[model samples]
Target chain A: MNEHVKPVELRKAFRLVNHGPTVLLSARNGSVDNVMAVAWCCGLDIDPPKLTVVVDTIAHTRSLIESSGVFVVQVPTVAQLELTREVGSRTLYKEPDKLRNSGVSICEMAGHDLPFVEGCSAWLACRLISEPHIQDAYDLFIAEVIAAWADDRVFRDGHWHFETAGPEWRSLHHVAGGHFYAIGEAFPADSNGG
Target chain B: MNEHVKPVELRKAFRLVNHGPTVLLSARNGSVDNVMAVAWCCGLDIDPPKLTVVVDTIAHTRSLIESSGVFVVQVPTVAQLELTREVGSRTLYKEPDKLRNSGVSICEMAGHDLPFVEGCSAWLACRLISEPHIQDAYDLFIAEVIAAWADDRVFRDGHWHFETAGPEWRSLHHVAGGHFYAIGEAFPADSNGG
Candidate 1:
């Protein structure tokens, strides 16, 4: 296990992606590997901690996941904003050493062959749930998380502790083009006991 | 057309749900109607602006939507936090007037039979694309945006302008229980000539 990365409970894994952060999706097929930023991702189930993410049909990471049936999802923090945008803004079609170009370094994840980004706030090792129709038609992929991890400084007790962390710990929420929103403060709603 | 809500170009409609907010999914069948907060939603296509959302099979809104074959996707802002949480916490299985119970008021959209929340940041009147396999298995639904609307104060000229608007225009991204992170400041990332 990497010193900075800590394991997150599988059941609590959904909270990792729950706050709508733009994530780095990495997939390795044999020796070939690819990492790309995906803005459209969300938690689908709680106990098993399933997730749904839209991978562009033409993206290199999409083909890798399709071929290998596995991928890793990692949430990038505000400090890596430029790196996240760079990864998402370009295609890995014929580019070699794409990860280096995006300034992303991979760390070894236990029991997973995929290369997980070193500085991401959280990571999820996923086995793709095969749904060819949607994969072909909508570029939407669903996966069940088998392993999860989070940076202890930002996430503990199954909740995001962003208040104590500095601004760099904040998650990124992209709007369009190169513009992104840093996730703001967390608050609880007063429902008047509804 | 409602004075506050105006038409959004279909091509730019993806911006409505681009930042990954939990939105109100509303549907009507015969005289029965339902509204529920769904956190799992994202834009699938850009030109025609299609969307894929997960509506739990047991949800009343799901049944109404499946029967009617149409629905509305409305983005609730920070001002609607309690209402969003209230609507998501309860089910309309046997209870009557669920919308009123959640303190949400409805306004009609043109050419649609459904009611959209009056103060929402944006609205997308959708026609279901009808992919049954995934719908049955994943509780996922894909739809084409027949029409889109956005509150002028928050969204304009093909982008979200949350900076100028008050917190009422800030979109809600739910984490779990009653916790949510209001979308914060927007910034542009500099690319290294990729």
Candidate 2:
């Protein structure tokens, strides 16, 4: 049986992206859907939860995200690196269902229409807040995270419990040259109790 | 004796920030200087190495960085968490030389007047590329990295060698609540030798 998890409050959703993990951006319009890897994204606002992500103007996923105004950002674990690279390099125009083609399983949550990769540790459903200047000038898209969710085993009560969780629960951080560093060694805040 | 490292070409300087590490933003306007921790940053362009960072309107570092038209971004290692938090929490208004107050060592690099924090894994000297719209809308500043250097022991030849390097060489990733995750396991791109 699949474990159930709750959606994080919109105000607190920025915490998920604040850590700067490389995410798999998923978008769908009508029957067409696609997923691409992105390392260039940051939290833009807190309340209503705005985020900025750079999606290349020529990318196949950009149009789908622009048209649908809704997309999902999935934080994948180290074991999913192969799948992440596959989806990242291939476009939806070339591969209609890259998720399935990459041999990765997908499931749709009860409330959100977008698909989340099964192996991902956390997911966020975002709605675009179009800023044409940023998009045209820097390929940056600002969006509000309407809904957010995460695997309870890894994230609960707004804190990551990577220590108790298995290694597969750790998020991936991308370096250059196609190399990636798995999130490691959690140290609690000095001000806050560990 | 301090090591003399060659400056990275401006075009390839973006690679320094391509991997998401929380950076220490140091700035100075005449005699006044300050430093703050910022995780909301990313590479805006490749050639000429333009990057963007969000600094709150209320921050003292904002005015200093703006007036100076120059700032240094230092990528700290895992061991520097205490120092990073010290610089992050204390405002320049409270203690102008927070670096000295906090007991963290600082050094000047290249032609940049601002002091870069010592013991950081990497450093970038930048000149502000003023963009009013995004700055007003998002508290973001676009800057071009004028000079870049890395501790060869940790980062060399366009890649981070965290594995071979000691724990002190590991880069930091900030999670919410003052928590951080160190850069962990690395995987090479191809199975065959390049």
Candidate 3:
């Protein structure tokens, strides 16, 4: 594990995805591992942290998640724009070298057998909750976050330091085909309000 | 109706919220109307657009949505940060004057009776797709967009022009407590990859 990768409290895990950045979902089935980008990931619950993600039926990574019953949701950075687009566009079923072609390297954390992308700002190890109906009808999957991690330089003390961190470390919010806006300008709301 | 609020094509409605900005959800039941800010609203599908939102059991807005089976999801801007915090923090059940105290003014469209929050960048009128199981167990609601609109200044021609619009028009992404990061720095990914 990278030295800057630190554990995030499960209660505070919702904050990792609360802002709605596009995320990388990676899973392994037997000796094969696959990765894909998802823009529909959302925070579902706070305690016993849960999140919702929409994985299309055609996505190869979706099958890996189903077979393993586990997957990793990692927050990719602005620096990974090209990588994000590639993973989202290509499929592992046709091209077995999709990961290598997309310039993706897999890393691992102790005690967790899932594959974690090498250069993301945060990681959430999730166990699928298995809502078969929604999964069949809408391609929507729900999962409970068993553990979480983040790069301390960008996120620490249970909060994101985007205002202070380098712009390259910012999260990517996808708009349309190949277009994205990096997160910017952090400020506290007026004290008189919430 | 505001002159700038033009109807958005149903196929393109998902783009209005694909970036994951914190949104204002409004609904009316009988003579009662209520609004709340949600960070969990996410795009669920493309054609005949659909969305999912996690509305807690205690929310006054949730009850209104359940009774009416309709609601409006509007993308609040950086300029509405204070209003967003106030509405999310105050409750319509306990304080009858929540809307007025929170500085929320209700506006309307030609055919829809729902309360639309003024000064928002985009709006999507939705009819609830009630999934009782998820609502009871997860506080989650799914809906199909019935109609959509956006301020031409910020969103038009089937795309979001945040890069050219004034900073105030940028969407707000909530982090925690009163903290938020405004959408920023629009750029295109390398075309060769995707």
Candidate 4:
């Protein structure tokens, strides 16, 4: 485990993706591991930490997730733009393998072969919650976040400190055609008419 | 109508929220009108423009949506930070009306009185799709975007030209408390390596 990867409380797990950064989805089936970038996902709950991510039926990673019944969602920082876009646009269904040169690495947890992307700020190891109807109909997968981890440098005390993490470490949002916007400066406001 | 607001092609409506900006939700039933902010939402489909936004059972907006069977999701610009936070934190369940003093305004469409945040960049007028189970269990509201609109200055030609929209016009991501990250910059990359 990387020294910066620390366990996050499930109650606070929602914060990892709550700000809506495009994420890299990873899954392993047998000896095969794959990764892809996705922007259509968000935290659905806090207690058990349920997350909803859309996975098209034709996607290879979707097959891997279905067969393995497990997957990981990693929040990549701006520094990983090329790798994120590469993996998202490329497919391994017809190719030999994606892990060999996908510019991402595998992070083993206990005995699990979890796929991870370098320069990412957070990770969510999830299990399928089994809502087959919606999964097939809407390409929407609801999963339970079994374990959560975050880079201590960018995330501490259950909140993101992107303002202090600098631009390279800040999460980025995908805006079509390979373009992205780095999550920018933070400011405070009070909604009490103050 | 604001000159900046114009109809967005229905098939391209997903692009408005595809980058994952926190949105201000507004609805009306009878003489009551309300507005609130939510971060857990995204486009669910493209063709018919389906969107999913989590509406907590306790939120006053949820009742209005249930009763009226319609609502609008407005993408607030960074400039509306204070008003966005105010509407999200305050409750209109007991208050007389938020439209009068919420610092936001009403943007009526044809015969509808949909509350909208001034200076918001995009709007999605929606009708509930009606999923009782998910509504009660997850507070999730899946709706079909019946009409879509965007600030032509920021979004045009089926794409979000946030690059030239400036800071205040760019969308934002909500990060707990009153802090937020205004969407910043745009750079292109290759989608190859397939």
List the per-model TM-score of the A chain: 0.94, 0.91, 0.97, 0.93
* Docking class of predicted structure 4: medium
Better of 1 and 4 by TM-score: 1
Candidate number with greatest TM-score = 3
Sort every candidate by lDDT, greatest first: 3, 1, 4, 2
**Local lDDT at B145 for model 1:** 92
Report the Cα RMSD per candidate.
2.4, 2.8, 1.9, 2.6
Error of 2 at B27 (Å): 1.1
lDDT of 3 by residue, B1-194 (tens): 57888989999999999999999999999889999999999999999899999999899999999999999999998888889898999999899999999899999888898999998999999999979999999999999999999999999999999989988898999988888889988866553312
- Candidate numbers sorted by TM-score from highest down: 3, 1, 4, 2
Error of 4 at B58 (Å): 0.5
Clashing pairs in 3: none
lDDT of each: 0.84, 0.78, 0.92, 0.82
Q: Which is better, 1 or 4, measured by lDDT?
A: 1
Q: Evaluated with lDDT, which candidate comes out highest?
A: 3
lDDT score at residue A63, model 1, on the 0-100 scale? 86
True contacts kept of 2: 0.60
Cα lDDT for residue A54, model 1? 91
Candidate 2, Cα interface RMSD: 4.2
lDDT of 4: 0.82
Runs in model 3 deviating more than 4 A are A190-194, B189-194
